[model samples]
Target: MSFTLAIVGRPNVGKSTLFNRLVGKRLALVDDQPGVTRDLREGEARLGDLRFTVIDTAGLEEATDDSLPGRMRRLTERAVDMADICLFLIDARVGVTPSDEVFADILRKRAAHVILAANKAEGAAADAGVLEAYGLGLGEPIRLSAEHGEGLNDLYAQLAPLADEFEARAARDAPETDVEVGEDGDEGALPAFSDKRPLQVAVVGRPNAGKSTLINRILGEDRLLTGPEAGITRDAISIRTAWDGVPMRIFDTAGMRKRAKVQDKVEKLSVADGLRAVKFAEVVVVLLDAAIPFESQDLRIADLAEREGRAVVVAVNKWDVEEHKQEKLRALREAFERLLPQLRGAPLVTVSAKTGRGLDRLHAAILRAHEVWNRRVPTAALNRWLAGMLEQHPPPAPQGRRIKLRYMTQVKTRPPAFVVMCSHPDKMPDSYVRYLVNGLREDFDMPGTPIRLTLRGQGDKNPWKGRRKSQPSALRKHLKKGT
Candidate 1:
């Protein structure tokens, strides 16, 4: 694990703002309203030359019971305990309040390394407040303006020694590098397991479609809060787990409703958070309620996933209550075919998030989708397929000359992208491109994964490609003399 820094403060003190600045992105939901952040968000933070893990925690409240604020407090406390250091922030504009005093005392007892920071200390208005922060007895406060990217150098100065210590410890603890040898004592290629990276999968859908239920069931525990209530999940909480022995990280996002219906500021943040999860995930499961599958919003969500180029898996939740199983299944197939033509052969697995039925099938489908998303085809095979395709239905030429496709090769994978060297590529019709893409999908067994096909015409060096070469004047005169 890397050095972890947990930012702790009361609500609206710019903890998230500081987090966004450090991470170089607006990952956490930032609002002027207090208590906007209700969960712990973690990001890889980079400040100057220091790189470490930074946690954005929910604001601390005075509550100590099991209420919502209380729960958020516990989560924040967990983050504090898990961190290597705690950044206790006080709002310089608001000055030190009783809540800041309370949290400061708590951090004094809980954290080994506590750094006090007075945020929003950009102008003379906060001078008195910045001086007042000294009464907390945690040492000189680092005056900061997180929104304006001020005071980071001082922050980095505080963190440099810690980062150096962590790097030294990590280097000391790292295992010696060694090469694997075959049974015959010859060096061998590294095993496939060496390439393992945590797979990110996000479960998304409309409100109350069992998104949380499905994720909890897959995890085999009630790690995430869930109930019959719609919109219970407000943050995109990502849980790390192993699915059937394969390491994976699953994100349970807030259910996204239509744009007009999302009026609450908090809900808007939640929706944006969910969209970010989808964009970050490697595979997106658009869980739909079987009773009301393929709603306009459902189609929109699936389309969004597809357009993002993430591998998609359509899952029908609440299958146990579904009546007329065979009829419903057939109808689902037909509806999927009719509605989502772009994701033509994407996996549509039926599962009951409540009863956990069909979970194994869903797991297999997810793994398969991930595999197809990362699939690669060899250059030889690609050119061969291109040849067969051109022979079957050659590109249509608008003028007299026929368009020539000279070379084709896979440019990259992870949603296989190809580039075809050709003549008159600009004139190639969209219909022909679609034809080639469909052929690639069908022949490559890469159903539902996005395919990128780029057509490139002859380069400038080959400017006279389609023109006939005229005989030289000297050759023409010699031929006339011979006649």
Candidate 2:
């Protein structure tokens, strides 16, 4: 029942800029290039005391069928349809164009409520464009510069009423079902520690990857012994800390090594323990040494997180020592892009865990990725995206028979697992599955979280079916016949 506010506009109109402004962090990639944002990105937005889900959609463009621009437009349209309120952003510096008019028409036909925002409206230069925005017919536009943080009070005032209305509607429509907490006596003396209560986040990586240092910084003390030794920490330790007033129980596990070279019993036990920690953790922060980033072991660990269905955040530690930091960062990003395509947009943060630099950003990224992990896209909107995906690139046929993926539903979250019922589950190729996972990751803005897709054959029959009629006599007769 969360309210969603979608920011929509043509390319280079500062939709991502406004998204970063509302989300209060520069999570979305910003570049001078047009259409840098190919996917729909979402974040939990806060405007003063007003809290809502804000979605940054792909730039709207007019294109012919089967083009990238057309697919991007379809993605934007889907986001607009799912939103309760739409914030239509226009570049006040450049004024409205034909693309803006087309999108405004689309919004007029689809969106229930719309708010016009004139971005880059700083000084007197933007006045004319702000006035020109009225041509869209949405209403008077609120002028602001996302980069400079100008005119936010007006934006807050505009959103407050919509937020209040959404809250009221949600309260009215809320279901009566409530989860009952069992008492200690009734539950046969509940354990003093409930492992499921506080969110468990695991910090894992290779040896000397700053796992121990990061934990020490987070706890603000020498809780775990940190040394120059390769395997200084031998056991997984759990510490309870409140991050930004949110209670979180973090698990710091020993560094993992390659299985073939695990010589000692202690190292084997530690590796097994680390794997178990990954399984238990709701979110896993994979720490990587900036000196040797994205090694084979790193990829293996990330793949393990994906296989285990855990939210992942890749942290590059000791970034301060690197000579060409930006260059190294770009190379690392490219490597991640090429190597781990499954986690297409996984959150990557560069931090100096030694000096406590970028800790705040790392924490924020972990929290944001966790939010995406727990996110659930509505059934209607998911189906809409699925239909668009199919139209864009139809799945390939196997043995002259088309593989029809009929329906998709989110069966579980906390690493968002989905079930896509199809005609032939076995015939579906791995490449096609990767295509769908990438599409879901991009369209749903579920970055940094492992998305699980399970294919179930439509023709598979349940064993429980028709079992009610066959009693003990039928089973005995079948046994006798077999004998």
Candidate 3:
């Protein structure tokens, strides 16, 4: 089982900042405004060699039982209940307030284990508050500045013991399970990750589409070589980055071209490398040139992602020089619907990779699309939807015999795949299958991620019955002897 940790604190106490620090990404929005985080965001968190799930919760605030703040508090309480440990953060610069004391009391009552953190403890300003945190009775607080990345080693030391204890308990409970070691070493080794880890995002497009330029701008450095030259990047190179404190691993792929034009051996190699990057990526951002958007190659790349069952987001790059922005966006939407019908509702964000205009929106759109792609529709809701669909348009009869699609169940997620057990699998037409897939995408709000519908034929006989053996030989011999 995955270990869970919750980051809890009052508003502007640097909970989001500490969350970003632990997760190593700015996934949670950080603003000076109080109560900015109204939702609980959970991600895999890593501290040194320790890995666990971490939930970033909304700030504790004053509200009635039915109010929004109260609802947020309930969410935080739920996180506390689910967590193996809680990291209670306080702003050392501001010192403890009545709200802090109230929340501390709540945490004492709710959380199973608590680790106190004195955030923003950079200068002498925070010394008094750090000393005052001892009054909370949560144990010694680890003083650190989340923004400047100070005192992390001390934080790790505090967490390592807890992690080791959890791991030891888990191992003791599962002694019979085989722990196979892989070529890399211990197969059972704890996964190296945390929610603050960078998201693995790949930028793919045809040659000379400014993929390199976009990556450089995002990094705010000349990390990847860029020029007016086409096919400069011959191999996929990944760069580790933090966007607004959101850890992101970006793969800049070589520009892909048609198979026929990729005659050169180096270009062919580059294409293969790019393809591999796309396969490995969790989310693919297809960058298109604003001047020549939605070409045959672009459609093919998008189709490749759908076929491979990867999440996709389209970015129309170099929009700074585009003459008719609105018209182009409209036409692009139509073309996406017409050409790449499978990814009909996938997000399309227009950006000038040159000027860095609309990059934020682009990032936001990619994150949202990824969330939808990874979404799981509950089995109950799915079956209800399926029943409604079958009621509206019953399966077509083949040879005047009605094909019974008996039951449907989701077999897998992450590009949700469903298996529909039916009377005749071979008789199901392609049109009807497409109808179901389309309906699933539209009704369930799953766009961009490929939906797989499979039909399993259930034959007319009960398979569990034992085979019958002939017993007439002995009786026939006995009758002959009597005669």
Q: Each candidate's TM vs. the true structure?
A: 0.76, 0.55, 0.58
Cα lDDT computed for each candidate against the true fold: 0.89, 0.83, 0.83
lDDT of 1 by residue, 22-71 (tens): 99987777888888776677888998777788988889989988776776
Model 2 over residues 255-310: C-alpha lDDT tens digits? 88888888876567667767887899988999999989989999999999888989
Scored against the true structure, residue 201 in model 1 reaches a CA lDDT of 93
The numbered model that scores best in lDDT is: 1
Ranking by lDDT: 1, 2, 3
Model 2 score (lDDT): 0.83
| Per-model root-mean-square deviation over C-alphas | 5.1, 26.4, 19.5
Q: Using TM-score as the measure, which candidate wins?
A: 1
